[model samples]
Target chain A: MGIAYPIAKVKGESADRIYGVKGFPSAALVDASGRVIWSGHPSSVPRGEIEKALEGTAFLPRLEGKAYKKVDKLIVSREYGKAHAEVLKGLQKDSADETLQGAQVSIEALLEKMQGAANAAVEGQDFGVALDTYSQIEKLFKGHEAAKLAKADAKAVEKNPAAKDEIAAWKKMVKADETQFEGDFEKAGKLYAAIAKKYPETKSGERAQAFLSRHHM
Target chain B: MKLLGLALALGAVLSGPRAAKVEVGDLAPEIYGEWYLSDASSLEEVRGRVILLDFWRTW
Candidate 1:
């Protein structure tokens, strides 16, 4: 998952300060030579004003409820999309120059491959594999337009931290010992039913219902 | 205006019946073998009068 952000440059200063904007991911400042100076989470900063303080522009996209089956997946996807968008935007400015043709071609190819992977992940039903592929795509594309699409779809529902806690609890149950797992399936079934009842529009809720439909028989 | 009205009436008349009649717990048509944990052997050609269809996945 990508968490780093672009650093805003200050003239006449040796060090660049990194500040995170809420609803986006963390980032670090990179000098003209691509050297990192500082980094932190974007959520710590103010909600929507961080973009104005930057010498260069970078915006972190927020997480969405519908896409978040688990908290980690949502956070990781949003962060990666933010970082990729910043880098891709920067690459486009220099890509047209004759001297940078070779580097530009490689970057463009990587961006295409990553976009393909992300699309595949979006279509995939298996959450784990889809997330894994989407993460790789974010790394590959770095800053393509598709990254923006992904970012927009994932920007709402970061208001509550309760979902994160619920995710942690759910992860513990899924990773419990085999004996415990077997006994807990009955409990898990009820939990799934409740989730389906509460969030019927979400994929997680649909999956919970599917589990019941299959297992209860 | 009259021709447009007539066309709209014909369109509605042509395309309205679209609801499903059959649902779950209805008498299902007969299908083949059981798909579960146990494997079938060639030694005995087993057959049964009643068939139960169950859908499942191995998470």
Candidate 2:
């Protein structure tokens, strides 16, 4: 049976855990802003609720009405830079458009999401990841708040006493991941084991252990 | 506002692994679908659209 409306078959319980779905065949209605509006079994969802919730929300990336297919597609492609440019053009025409404003906010949210990761890495004492993620944000999101935050975080990481070793291990982990992605599991496995052993208490080390165990290496 | 779950965009690294038992008012968690059964690959692809996330088990 063919179904429409963006249904997906999730692989793990990550979604299930996040949504707190305690049973099978459950559902949740999510709004344009990624918030849960309503949730229940399919048949039990409120009659006019869907309409009301989706009323001002657009089917496009971050708009209120009408799908901006072209720009939306760029966003779908993760071309945030290009998508941001396109949104700026739209703003030129309709400076007060809620949709364009929403799009800009969404872009910021995405960048902020990345910044959150960097922050999390710092919390986890994963200096390598904190530095790497922050550096990437500094480069890609030059003008955004995420970029600003990343700059501060990166500086902090550089100041940490043990950053050098952690960063070196992370670089090696990056190489190992590249090798694994390139289909050299054998070498990658060895590399992971080595990193895990060398950086035993760090985030990269834990990740290496998780990877090895997950892959049965 | 958007339904974006940007993954590894910066330097193609990796991102959040999120959330808890969310009730009606909580912000929905990002989806991690190993397989996409629709035209969309990521949540961002279907942004701005209302989503009905059906959590089920293949008995």
Candidate 3:
């Protein structure tokens, strides 16, 4: 097992210059022959999976037709952009019930496993496995509080017809995240300010206020 | 006794970092409970695979 820290680089810099920035604890597994078999977030991917990834024996689960259908429906619905809030509300309710079930299990069990496995793989400097683990963490997060917030945000947008333009502007702001894109934060700040001005009581306005404060030039 | 110490050490390692985003090197936090795959298999069954779990609001 091996441990590797995450690298945070600007547009131009050596890949090795990761200083001060915090990294999530992720692990990777390596085989006897020094090959990566598995890797994932330090908290969730089981140690056993890391071993498998390191051994080149990791079995990627096949998504079934039903899951595909559900995802397709979600995508289609999101594109139309109506009823999204209600949809998110329903999904949040369902997810809440499922999350309650997970409480019975030991979260530490999975976290330890993934960490051990990642530790093994990082020894090989196999970043592909590292990236895969990050993806897994992204997936695992859907069942979390942030997912609920996302759902609520969607529902809120659905409730107010007048907020459509504001929501679109907010979406653009998110898409232009500094790490992801070189977005004009100044424009986003203006949009957020406008949304706040229009709907003083709305969460969108509140979020916009925060955005303006955080990304102020 | 050594095994117990190792177990404790692992426990500390497991609970170490908390980050908002799931980065490559960060620990994956337990967002919720048992996640079931489309195959009707419990998430526990695929403990070793990197999973891309996405939550979408269906309209």
- Which structure among the candidates has the greatest DockQ? 2
* A1-217: candidate 3 lDDT, tens digit per residue: 3412112112211111111122233344333222223344445646565444434422212223552344334433222121223334545667654422232122323333444554443344332233334334334334444334434534543455655554454444343332211223344456657766775554445555665554342
> Using DockQ as the measure, what is the rank order of every candidate, best first?
2, 3, 1
DockQ for the candidates, in order? 0.01, 0.24, 0.03
TM-score-better candidate, 2 vs 3:
2
In the range A137-214, model 1's lDDT, one tens digit per residue, is: 444334556555544422321222433433333333233312122334445557667666765554555655665674
Using lDDT as the measure, which candidate wins?
2
lDDT of 2 by residue, A1-217 (tens): 5533444555545556555565555778877655577877766867586677665353335333455776787665556666777888898999997778888887767676667777888887788878877776776565545567778878878888877778778888878766653334567779999999998777778878877775566
Candidates ranked, most accurate by TM-score first: 2, 3, 1
**Candidate 3: C-alpha RMSD after superposition:** 19.6
Worst 10 residues of 3 chain B by lDDT: B1-10
Q: What 10-residue stretch in candidate 2 chain A is worst by lDDT? A: A56-65
The positional error of residue A54 in candidate 2, measured at the CA in angstroms, is 20
Q: For candidate 1, state the interface root-mean-square deviation in angstroms to 1 decimal.
A: 32.5
